[model samples]
Target: MRILILGTGGMANQHAKHFAAIEGVTLAGGVDVDPARVEAFNQTHGIERGFGSLDAALAWGEFDAIANVTPDSIHHPTTMAALNAGKHVFCEKPLATDYAKAMEMTETAERLGLINMVNLTYRNVAQLQKAREIVQSGQVGTVKHFEASYLQSWLVSKAWGDWRTESQWLWRLSKKHGSNGVLGDIGVHILDFAAYGAGSDFSKVFCRLETFSKAENNKIGEYDLDANDSFAMTAQLENGALGVIHATRWATGHFNELRLRIYGEKGSVEIQHRHDWSKLLTCLGDDIETGTWTEVAVDPVPTNYMRFVEAVRSGQNLEPSFRHATNIQKVLDLATVTDRDRSEHKV
Candidate 1:
């Protein structure tokens, strides 16, 4: 299978690396806005073809699929182009910054009968899969309240960028370059995870976004820095479960932490993914003090990339499909609206 990757920044290389590991996949080439990045990415990944634009790549590079690793703002366009070109697309989430555009992309893919998958990475995690199964099996009873968080300390100080060749911190802060800051970047992952584990959709959201250090730390001409650095929201899942979502790039001393807990009438489940994959935890009975949260073992499944490839090969519908992602995007769009209304009332 031939696959062309779009965007040379962020996790593009990681996507390339994983695609190369697939049994029958080839990394045809990639396109980037930066010529230097295009050259560097090609050299580092050992891909032979590189293009300056998506049109060039699509025209000249023959491929069966596109792994779009572009920034959030361009996700809709890139995926649409790939789908229109008759290539399957594996896009990173939240599908698009614009909710209407996201819906259009989803509809286009469906209308074309193309295999479209969203890179909601956590859905591919083994422990989380186990958690989902346990909850869906009625082992946990009906979910009541849940909390999930994705946290990182990169934006706590500018030093994170000094070490990496490319850091998304500044671009993420620019409304022109990126999508919703902390919420879109990390919070979406939490929402996907919670929704996947709880076996329900989000019915409503009440959100609060923060950009705490940007005003004080940013130099006058440095950056507009309008994107959020942190966010917290409460949501009601379709199962009547009350859930809380929190994400931030300003947490000190933590590199990357994603943790979730789902409580139910009979028991609760907790899962965490950080430096290493943690075990799935489950507790039965109603006794809080005396109950024990034991670890539940889970067998590994194929990576998200592998699943996408398999779906493409077999003509099967992909999980976390474009439609699934659009629902998540709707929650995010509504969250922003809810936040705006609440903030305006406070004024």
Candidate 2:
């Protein structure tokens, strides 16, 4: 399968690395707004068809699919164009900056009978797969409550760049480049993973967003800092389970910590991404309090590269597909409105 990748940013580079290692897949080349980066990326990867424009590449580049690794704001346009041009798309998360656009993109792909998958990377984690199995097997015994938090200290005021204009964080802080701030950036993963583990969609939500650090160019009071830096929300599942999801870039001393705990009548399970070993732990039965939580083995899940290639070859849809992602998007949309409207929002 021939594939063209959009964006030469970090995620694009990561996708390229995976594509290189997968058999039966060819990296057709990549496209980026920066011509130099595109040229350098092609040369570094030994690819021959890099282009600076998506339109130019879609017109002349012969490829079966596209890896939409661009920013959140561009996902809708890029995926729609690729699907319209008869190319399957593997897009980054929060499918689109807005839920309406996400619906349109997914509908278009469905109408075309094309495969559309979102890179909710946590789905491919071994621990999460086990968590899903545990929950579905009744091991958790009807989850009653759950809490998930994804924290990073990189966005703290003390860590801010010397100047906003020279700061690489400007785009994220500005609505012109991205949306939903931390909520869309890393919060979507938490929502997707929680839903994946619970095997149910969120039915209601109440959210609060915070922006502790303001962004500025070289001069103060030049640009408005509108994006959120932290968010906390309480959500209820269709199964009537209640949970809270909190995400922040201001957690000091935490580099990248994503922790989730699900409690049920029979037992409970915890998934920790920061821990190097014993990432999945569970305790159950009457002796739950006295008994120790045993480690669940981490059996690696299939890589997205493998899944995408096989799905393309077999003409089969893959899990974490756009349809599944739309459910998560509904949760996010509700959370946004709940924060804005300050009322219990139904999904």
Candidate 3:
């Protein structure tokens, strides 16, 4: 499979590296608004060509697929263009800035019979995959409750770098810069984590979002740091499970982590992915009586990148597909409404 990397940002490097590492895939070219950045990305990834814009690359039309590493807002248009051009797409998370756009992208991709997938990076965690398997296999015996959180201390420390001065970090904090804040950013991951691990989809959500002041007047140069910094939600799953899901950039002490605990009639399962390490623990059968939790050995799973290549090759869609992402976006969009009206919404 020949791939064109859309957007030569930080995430694009991972896309290029992963695709290039695949045995039969080629990194044919890269695209970015900045010519210099695209050229540098091409050189770094050993790609043969670079284009200053998506239009330029599409006109050349040499690649079979596109890795859309563009910003949250740009995903809709660029992905639509790629699908219209008869190219398969592997897009970054949240799919689009809003539910309507995400739905459109999902519908178009499906109607065209194209392979469309989202990079819900947490799906690659072996523990998460294992937890899902356990829940689905009836070991947990009807999930009743769950709690999930995605934590990051980027705003509290320089572990990831100074967000006050960096454009990459600044853009995420500003709504005008096409950011949906912490709620739109990591919120999707935690929602997916809880729902996927529990083998259920959210049917109702009540959300509260908070945007903490990070600067004087919350203004940083041309950027308005008004995007949400934290959010907490209570939701009902399709399988009749109740779950609490939340995410925050102000979680001090933690660099980046996703933790999920699923409670069922028979037992409970806990999964944690901190930094880069993941582990799964369970309390089942006789162990549930003593409240003993035992660690479950989990094997690694293929990443979304690898699955995208496989899906492209086999002419079949895969999990975390555009349709699934659109449903996640529906929940996210309703989250903003719930926050505004201070009320719960049915998804």
The numbered model that scores best in TM-score is 3
Better of 1 and 3 by TM-score: 3
Summarize candidate 1's per-residue lDDT along 1-347 as a digit string, tens digits: 99998998868988999999988899999899899999999999899998999999878848999999998988877888888999999998888986799899999999998899998988777889998888999988989999998888876655456312234666777566675887888777889988898888887788998876555554224445677888888888878999788998877877887888999988899998886656788897654557888887888888889989998999887798988888888887777887888731110
Task: List the global CA lDDT of all models.
Answer: 0.83, 0.83, 0.93
Ranking by lDDT: 3, 1, 2
**Which regions of candidate 3 fall more than 4 Å away from where they truly are?**
none
Candidate 2, run of 10 with poorest lDDT: 215-224
Query: Which prediction has more favorable TM-score, 2 or 3?
Result: 3
* Shift in Å, residue 149, candidate 3: 0.5
Cα error, residue 335 of model 1, in Å, equals 0.8
Best by lDDT: 3
Residue-pair clashes per candidate, as listed? Answer: 0, 1, 0
Q: Between 2 and 3, whose lDDT is larger?
A: 3
lDDT of 2 by residue, 245-311 (tens): 9998888877677888888999999898853433999997765979679887877789877788778
Q: Lowest-lDDT window of 10 residues in candidate 3? A: 271-280
Candidate 1: regions farther than 4 A off: 157-160, 163-167, 215-222, 285-289, 343-347
lDDT of 2 at 288: 90
